[model samples]
Target: MTQTHPSPAADTGPGQWNPRLWGLLLVLAGNMLIDALEVSVAVVALPSIATDLSLPLTDVQWVMTGFAVGFGALLLFGARMVSLLGRRRVYLAALLGFAAASVLSAFAQEPGLLIATRLVKGFCAALTAPTGLAIISTAFPQGRARSRAVSVYTLFGAGGFTAGLLLSGWLTEHTWRLALAFPAPIVLLLFALGLRLIPNENSTTAGTPPTGHRSYDIAGALTFTLALLTLVYGITALPEHGLGHPLAAGPLAAAVLLLGLFTLIERTVSHPLVSLRPLRSGALVRSALGAACLNGSYLGMLFVLTYQMQTVAGWSPLKTALALVPAAAPPAIAALASGRLVARFGAPRLIAAGAACAFTGYLLQLRPSWPLDYPGRLLPTLLLVGAGFVLSFAALNMQATSQLPPAERGAGSGLYQTAVQLAAVVAVALVAALLAGAEHAAGPAAATSAGRPALTLVAVLGGLGLLTALTALARPTTPTPSVPRT
Candidate 1:
């Protein structure tokens, strides 16, 4: 594919900010905040959901994993939809769908119905999330303005998870259903604003292939989605059922087969869902991997800690949310300054530093003595974790799409977000499995014993992310070859 550059006029610069542009940015970022909020708002309410619905830990976790599966599975397809349908149409439609799904989730009496509604919401999010980023990439100039815009966009995403936690804490006390339904009105408003603000032009720009070259790759999409779903199901079931059981073994085996088939399909497809060429870019891969680790570990930590505080520590929902504020609030404030930081110090360094901070925080929580100290120990850990997000979240978002051509930005965003959602799926599933197994064995003191191994796993994930970021920093930069005048 040919590389395309933004026209000089696209920059508009810092001095040329207009109300319309700001409105557009606000619309995009607000939608992004809602997409992110979906990931965590249900987290604090999970225990309540499980109890009210008479669910086990493994089953109730599907409330979380279901959304991730739907989001990750359809993201590439959503990018294609953006190219075919135009970003404005897709964004508005998805927002409407999200509102409807949120409403369905609120009234769902059966666990199956609830999980299905969550999946629908996730699919809507998959569409809106990448579409929002793609619109930003096309609308903003590729310098300070764009960087700052992306920082603000991502800041809301990081903060949204925190906001969700706080919201869930308050809402879940009365009913978990309110926590599930609250996003409906908010998203409906975004939909109304988006109808006006999102550009009408299709996301496909100069570098896009002709319509003849495009293919839906439906087979690949189905295969890949099923593979992920199966993998998650197997992992979630493994702790309770063990490898010998059909529930665990069947899905695991099928996942492997489906993954192999999906890879084959991607390699053979004309217009592959995800282009293989970009995967070769170390920076892109590093950004995706680093993001996956950061998100996965952070969420996994939250899942484990929520249980610890609520179950073991006997804390109220609101109190637990307040105590955990340090882990989410710092990132929101820090992200405001990240665009300048990325401009000055570069993304790799910040990513490494962030990973290190998160790893240290997780390490602090690894060996929690019974009767865990809140202020001295856990509080510091949350602060460090939040700091890690502050340092890395915006940098990761900026770096992931920085090198991609305009036409490929949507796909690039999809791939990046897919990594994030997949990471959440795996991390939450694994953490849930470990916690469930430990609790089953430990009985009354489940949270105390169960949390240690989960925390250790989170730390390991952080350590690996740190290593990946450090590798990116350590690698020598290669200059692009200059083309001689024809």
Candidate 2:
């Protein structure tokens, strides 16, 4: 909620550090890193968490799913939350809430309690993540300086997953609780700095909608939330009960109906939660699809690889985590350079090339040839995937928001992130389902056999994403709307 705008006198010259600007950037980037950490940290620790809590793997998967559900479900209204509460208030409150949830998770004795805490943390993230970016937009002067700041900020975000992987690998060695507890202190530190450096809202723009008047669409929010929750529930249950089973079919059917109703509500409402007008933009549609596919395939692929490394390859947690270091870390550098890369090759080209790289990586990783060839097979694939992520992720984000008017940028970002979170949930669930189905087909070799098909599906997703990016590239380009001066 800090509303600090950069002063004209602020020097953001390359190689010259402005103390105030750097401090502000640190605070913002640090918080962004925390959000990113929460995402990847728990993923690596899931096996440990399940063992400690006496839960099945299916149930442990919900710790990650819960976060995705909470994040995706509420993000549709994040802009509304900002408008109603004021940005600084929501940012600070969500930070506090996130810290509290982390603490609760650290102490949780029951699986249900731990999952609930993750949900709270994720909901808090929905509130904080967009606000952090908004703060950066306000705090930094537009043009090259802002671009540099954003690239740095995003680079930190990319690095966070790697940091989390390394940290969780070490922390989970003693107890998974330490990994859960790690963020609380970091959040508190950021909160204290935020209190001092975060600027107060200008009286003119404080506590008011942009166009003088706009109302929150409560009905639309409720319906959309329910629809997403139902959808996730159905998909998550698919592994337990086949798709045709009543438990799975019922929720899936209801989700479709609820989503239909939500769309109708959006169309009818005077001040809709989302502006349906933007939905018609084919560029935005394809960009969002590209993001979903990229995340879905990447995360699902990681899930299977993690299992293969641990259970089949007989590697320790530390060794497994270290093996993935190449995939997790190099993307930070790639993200920083992506802006220039996009300028030369264009976002669509980068996206297509990135997806192709990811697909190739998956193909290389296919089947692993019995005695697990780490150096010959896995290392090269990891590097390829890492390079692909660096290329695609930032470019897709730029493309998604490129066509939006300034006023709707926040909502556009929320929508794009919503696609990411929802896709992650879907990816995990589908992979779970594939693995389960493979068990019946493979019998004695279920553990090893299950991974091949799951990985093949991941490769298919990568190919589909590549095709979508190419389709977008083939279309005529629309001129991006200019941001009007304040």
Candidate 3:
């Protein structure tokens, strides 16, 4: 197979990092931080929102689910849009849309409207998050420079959740609306800077004209989105309504069929939204799976812990957020050193080690005793989980995109992020279902028991991630064959 090299403008030589490039990276990483912040900011605020809106816990969880669904469902379509519309256009538009959605969320009175705003913001995030990574993948040259850039980019993302928790804790004390509205001005500022910093795709592609003739895969997009929505809906309903119930059974059945149809559509489409070619890469597949497990388990565990601290222990939002700081802070600090760690230990080793640490952390939290020990029990678990992300998150992102060709980087990023978001959706739904079931069976007095199942589920997910990484580590490396001199 003949190889294609990046344009000279795209691939900077060693030690050639310029000021403009650094500025562009910060812009991209800033957007990434905001996107991640959106996911976790509402978490600490959920109890406040539930009380304010007079909604049940299950219903209020939709704020988080709505965003995940919107982000996950449209990611492939967003990738297609990146290829169709220029990255600069899509990115700027998405930023504007994100700011608008955040503003709307602040003023929303009805539950449906608030959820709608979250969904729209999530859709905007779907476009920006992957596009930012694609930009980074292309803007930085391969090897050390790209690896370091990815670390910084992912570092902001890793820290964003922690930042959101702290911010939401303070903001929710004054008003939950502020938690929802806070990203608007920041995103607008990013839009202003992005307009000047982001390069035109045409300019960077060595003068290749945009492909206007290629048809968009509308069928694939619709099927995939519908499938994901239904799947999440079904999972969310499973514990409340048994599988026999129409709400649980119907959507689950439809999701399976829709997924099959989506597969067929991708096989037949001339310009498929997701090309199967990149999916064939083992490194990409492992990265996606590892990322999914990491995100799913971590978010699911957070959902349970938030409720445990607030409802069971009667801890205030700010207090709960402070206690959980161990889980969120270490990743940021550790990510700064991850590029070097990956260079030394390799991504697969880091992935496996990270997963093991997280798995142990989750195991420690399982079947916890009532009085809620922070330093002995929760602190260690949180620290291990944080360390897990510190070791694996950047490695996962780097591995996923580094192996793909430049042309497929956008799709690869979208696919990797889609896995992450969808996994969170499913995991959160599953944990919510389990908690609801435990509550229904034993009532509110059994809250401690309710969390046990959820914690066990999180540990199971971490174990699965560990196994996947170990498999990757166990795979034998194929030696490159040397060419004979003519």
Candidate 4:
């Protein structure tokens, strides 16, 4: 069967460069970068924040996990909100909310107040991140233009992690408050430009249904929120309270029950928060698995490596950040170059290749040496890991969205982003568990011994992701014929 790809936006010829379209991409990509930047920027500033507020080490970490929990939990609900209120309206409002949260965070005198602000910012981010990608998918024509836009969008997102690390170090050196203050001005500026740039209508993705007047599904919203929040909280808490502890197992069990209830509600309700129909697509299922593995492996690798750099190698924050540049830079470059290649080789093969590279990177890092050599031992791992990101990240995002109709694009984006956040949470937990076990066994030199198990766990994750991507490739291929614009 030849699939006819129909784009929501008016198609300009391939040679024609539209300034307005590019402007929209810039605003959306910038928004994506800001959301991702928040996740990492605070990481380097946590110690400074802890000192200023006199918080315990364990409590201080909630400043980060709180944000991730809120961000991941509200995603599906946010997509439902976008369906009710327009995307343009939700996008701008979310940005405004983010700005306000940033200001509150800057002025917060207590840890409680600061954590509240972080949660608010995370919720707002949940609103904007998926909407930005949906906006791009709807604004660009289906083939080359959409592909390029996704590549650029993914590149900015990948780059933001590195940006946050560098910025946090500099800002925290001056004042940790500066790190908190930075996002307000940037978000407000983007909000202003977005009013002029983002498309006003609902046709932001391929199969988006017309938005007129529909009663909001409040039941669906509540069930979905409770389910996701419980799941995220359970996984994040696992590191603090061992997996056998009630704190870890209780919430996870409740999360499972709530999710089951949510599924039942969705099936029975006339209006659902998430339709399970689109999930039947093999491509989307595999892409979601690929996304899970990609984030899980990459983040887990970073978790163990950070310990290796700081605890074992005695590297300063500045030195660690600089050393990570090789691991971060290649993805951005690869993302830009990958649009054409994605079109030629297709997303599945590239995804498999990327996962394979990441697995190989982890394999190379499994050496249990006492004093790790950076150039001889670590540099090649970083390079391969970066190369793996370059290949898989954009392709995963693109493949997930490529087949969805506009109406379903919001759901698709929400699902993809949720996979990413949940994977990161799970990955960190898994690595933490492995590290804990290693430490218990190794006693005095636990730091040196922990790296091997952590890296091995990451390698296993990468291999699973590679297997998922290969399955996507095994699906029957059909010609994707472009539908001409009116």
Maximum-lDDT candidate: 3
Pairwise TM-score winner, candidates 2 and 4:
2
Return whichever of 2 and 3 wins on lDDT. 3
- Candidate 1 stretches with Cα past 4 Å from truth are 1-23, 137-152, 202-210, 401-413, 477-486
TM-score of each: 0.88, 0.89, 0.89, 0.82
Candidate 3 local distance difference test against the native = 0.83
Steric collisions counted per model: 0, 2, 0, 8
Q: What is the C-alpha RMSD of each candidate to the true structure, in Å?
A: 5.5, 3.8, 5.6, 6.0
**Candidate 2 residue spans exceeding 4 A from truth:** 1-19, 142-145, 203-214, 405-408, 440-445, 477-486
Q: Mark the 10 consecutive residues where model 2 has the least summed lDDT.
A: 477-486
- The lDDT values for all models are 0.81, 0.77, 0.83, 0.75
RMSD of 3: 5.6
Cα lDDT of candidate 2 equals 0.77
Q: Is candidate 1 or candidate 2 better by lDDT?
A: 1
Question: Whole-model lDDT, candidate 4?
Answer: 0.75
lDDT of 3 at 409: 72
The digit string of per-residue lDDT tens for model 1 on 128-216 reads 87677777776765566776677778778768888988998999889989999998998888777766666555332323423655577
Q: What is the per-residue lDDT of model 4 for residues 200-223, given as tens digits with 9 covering 90 to 100?
A: 653444445356647567787677
Give me candidate 2's TM-score against the actual structure.
0.89
Candidate 1 lDDT trough over 10 residues, lowest sum? 477-486
